[model samples]
Target chain A: MSGEVIRRARGAVAALVLVGLVVAPWVVDDYTTALLARTLALALVGVSVALLTGVAGMPTLGQTAPYAAGAYACAVVGSRVSDVGVVQLVVAAGAGALLAALIVPLVVHARGVIVLMITLAIGELVVVVLGRWRSVTGGTDGLAGVPAVRPFWGLPALASDQGRYLYALVVVATLVGAVLVLLRTRAGLVLRAGRDDETRLRASGHRVAVHLSGAHIAAGAIAGAAGSVLVVAQQYISPADFGFDTSALLLLGVVIGGTASVGGALVGAALVIAVRDWLFGVLPGHAPLVLGALFVATVYLLPTGVNRARSRLSEAAAPQPDPPAAQERATVGEVGR
Target chain B: MTAVAVGTNRIDPYLIPALDGVAYGLLVFVAASGLVLCFGVANILNLAHGLLYAIGGYTAAALLDGGWASLALALAVGVLAAAAAGVLLAGLLTPVATGSHLSQALLTFGVALAGGSLLVAGFGPDDPQVQVPATLEGSVMVAGHRYAAYRLVFIVVAAVLAAALYLVVRRTRAGMLVRAAVDDPEMVACLGVSPARIRAGVLAAAGALAGAAGVLGAPIIGPGTDTADTVLLLSLVVVVLGGLGSMAGTLLAALAIGEIQTLGVALLPAAAPFLLFAAMAAVLAARARGLAVRWRTA
Candidate 1:
């Protein structure tokens, strides 16, 4: 449709997300909201993942390395050294970014599946080192009993899971919102263009490798920050927290929900967590079989993801293109940089 | 006295141990074979392949620990059980293999997650170990020290299996079909072979290999969540280092990596991982494009 309508629709979606963030915790149980809080904390990684994979076409398997880095940094810093939330987050991001910077350059020139293989290998390396390095990581069982991170300006406590979920909710919301805005900016637009057509962008004189490197580090930073927040909320840090399984599950969530929109990450996260717990109770030996089957079906039926599929199906049924006026109105939508 | 004697005699510590690395290498080979088959043949980088290994360990542990009627039966059932699971996963993954690697990765990752959950639920997140069969236990002298007899058997069995695979792939009709299938499925189909059947058979074979490795190595690795991720990484390292669709490369790579891991640990216990990564990084950097090459023939 017209640019004005499209802009307005975007604004509406933003409003809906904001409203949902405020009201959602009031209704859902402590476990789900906490899980959602984890998802929100975790979604920041997805944002960077969407940036790199959805836009830049890099298949990275160890997004969780950064997440684990951030988590452990936050844990060690928050619990052992200090309780300041800001310091923890900064350390998480800084540590993650530093690690990503070191490794991403090594594989920056790789694309598609190779990037994933390298990252998955890195992920294993991170876990293995952490699991073995007893002095820093506390070894295999993980560090338990991290304090509830912080309340703003020396505020009073919400110590229970519900209260912690609410606190985490605010942090996750602000970060996710900031990222969503950042993705709407010039760098994001350029990355999307690079993803869609790297050669053409390179022909137009953009340093594609440099851009990919930036996205890789940025993703790690986001993941690291999420890990930091996770440590705060869980009040526990263990090798198990940032295990490869966590990375795989998050990636699985992205796959189930499809990657085009932020909502897909959310849906994927909720579906993944809920299914695991439910299956734990019900599925017995057939758990992998069922999950694998579900994933396979999702691929065949809605490869573009649920929302994309819905949009496509609806558009197919409606048989109407956006009005010329609408298309003409939002040149800003095309404006990336 | 033994340690002093061994140190004074100065027997070639490096060489025999290097040979000793062969047994460990063979174990990794059997373990990685299933993954190579799935990754190259089915074109699915199944994230949950390690979970299958872990499950195999658990299956062996449960049967052997739970007082199953026969140790041989437990091993057989454990391997078959894993193969059956593979067949089931093959059915699930066949449709999605055509999708983006991300989707395939996610599907498999989710399965891995669910697999972990199932493992925890069933085994209560505790470590489970399969008792070494009496026949497989005890040690044989290798590098001035007695090594596990089972490991020697492992080396022999894995070597035999690898030879059989080479023979099958090189000399047999099925090998010819698989080689041709890798090049072009459409062409293979036109040549009067069912691609689906071949794919299923390869996947099942992969599962069997993974299961056997899991059960056999359970005493060494144990039944745990670590099984999936570690084995998966090793498999990736093997197939990639060796180059896809090259059994020789897979074997050689598996041995090299196995040696790297063991020797690295032997030399530097705390810093083995970095050494591991450094080796891979050097290799990958040396041949930037010699990674996974999906051969598409017109």
Candidate 2:
């Protein structure tokens, strides 16, 4: 297919996804609606991870820091303002980006395990602070009494499961669109390069740190937005919600989904949630064991992610006429070594 | 007389916690030593290090119901089990040894999660505590203050273990090969030595050490669902803070962190939780890489 045709097809797929989300609430039952809302928010987090770890070549175990920041920001803002979901979400995203900015310098130059460890530490630090500052965060019990989400000032409050689910869907779809657009920009190209070869980028006189900072900030905003949606959907926020497990789960989702693709984030998120909820029902008490096994299997057998299987099938069916240079560029990019 | 009294008063407050801190520090070293060795020699940071520790702890706890000889046997069994786990992990990781550390870390993390779940399934949700043997269960006087004799014995045992480990790594032929592999695995392979075998050996040894620490130190922290995760986090911190592939650095950092943790808790309860992370952040801020190995692939 030609470039314009491929772009149009991509846009059509995105639009279909948005439409499906819009109608999903009415189609599914209340229970699934609530579940879908939570899953979408979590998938947004996977998108953020995909951006930083997959695209930017900086794997983080600390995406939860921005996530928790957004959650807390929403909770704090909700307590002051009666019903301002949109405003609260904006503030939360800004908070997440700000927090990421503060943390970038600490981890910017570190590589591999160092980056992972520092990010993990930053996550723990946030948890510790949230737990210690009881007066603000409500400590271990978490903050309660968050007002029902209002999409805007005049819209009806999202008190019902369907309302909240729709709210979450709209917010997540917008963020996903934003991320997809961002990933096609010059900054995204630089990030992809940085991930592939930082030394080369440095030699070329590109300040690698600037690109990294941009990726982190963008990731932070996405995660923060997810957090805000999550708080509104669940109507609660706690320190436990944004712990090591959540961070691990988010990273796992990205890896499982296809870190290089936006759709992979959504698929990965949906799969993880299904494993947690549906698999729990199927296996009774062995959900974690099953999930762990799945993770191992995914890493060992499907290193490129589940999406690779579909992409391969599609390629076999309808192979595009690719120019040799694109393949050469892909080989050169070699995003994650 | 007033000057002496004031000096004693000032020193008296921290003296006991400091001693306790030393014991805790020694245990941390024991737990982290194998991790450091594995990273140094194999260039693979095993996230399941904590699970190994917990395995040792659970085995020792389950077996400590018998007499003194049985207790010793239990410790040996725990160490062996952990070593076996190490071998299995090494076997699994060998295929992907050349991959990025992120993937390696994720794979090991999956192993940890599975192992942790299995532990919870076997032991239930309750924390498992090992009963200290009658001989080492008493209290000892330290400047007129009473302290757990078991903790003191633990400090001694760990110190002896540390010395033995240092000597073995520094003196033995096997240790020479291990060190050579750490420096350059390709060169060692060229010299007709299989670096993979050496790495597996180091991993087993490290696993044994972690197991020993788990069993011996389980009495202090106890074994539970969170045990593996907590230990993994701390060991990762120690590995990073001490710099990869540096045993001495690992030991010193562990001891200092142990003190900082204990003293921080005793002095300021509110700030205690953040102390380790705070220290780590400060170190990384001052030195971007902290203490880093020569060859790092992230």
- lDDT: which candidate is best? 2
Q: Kindly provide the TM-score of model 1 when superposed on the true structure, using C-alpha atoms.
A: 0.81
Pairs of colliding residues, candidate 2: A112-B298
Models 1 onward score TM values of 0.81, 0.90
Which ranges of candidate 2 are over 4 A from the true structure? Answer: A2-12, A305-337, B289-298
Highest DockQ: give the candidate number: 2
- DockQ of model 2, rounded to 2 decimals: 0.36
lDDT of 1 at A40: 66
DockQ per model, Cα? 0.21, 0.36
Model 1: fraction of native contacts: 0.25
The digit string of per-residue lDDT tens for model 2 on B1-298 reads: 9999999999898988899889888888999889888777776758789999999989887888636886788889999999999999888777653435555767787788888889889988788768888887889998989999989989999999999988998999988888787665667888998767887898899899999999889888678887887787778777767776467878988898889878778988777766877787777667664333232421
Ten contiguous residues with the weakest lDDT in model 1 chain B: B289-298
- Clashing residue pairs in candidate 1 (N, C-alpha, C atoms within 3 angstroms): A1-A326, A1-A327, A2-A326, A2-A327, A3-A326, A3-A330, A142-A238, B50-B228
| Residue-wise C-alpha lDDT for candidate 1, range A1-337, written one tens digit per residue | 6999988987798688768877777878777666666766766666555555555566566887888888888888877776767777889999888888877655675555556667888888788778888888888888888877665547654577767776676777677777778779988888777665454577788987788888888878888888887876677777776666566666666655566556566557657766765765696766655765565556577665533222221111111124332223222121000
Q: In candidate 1, which residue ranges exceed 4 Å CA deviation?
A: A1-10, A23-36, A80-82, A147-167, A274-297, A306-337, B1-20, B54-80, B110-136, B224-226, B292-298
Q: What lDDT does the true structure give each of the candidates?
A: 0.69, 0.78
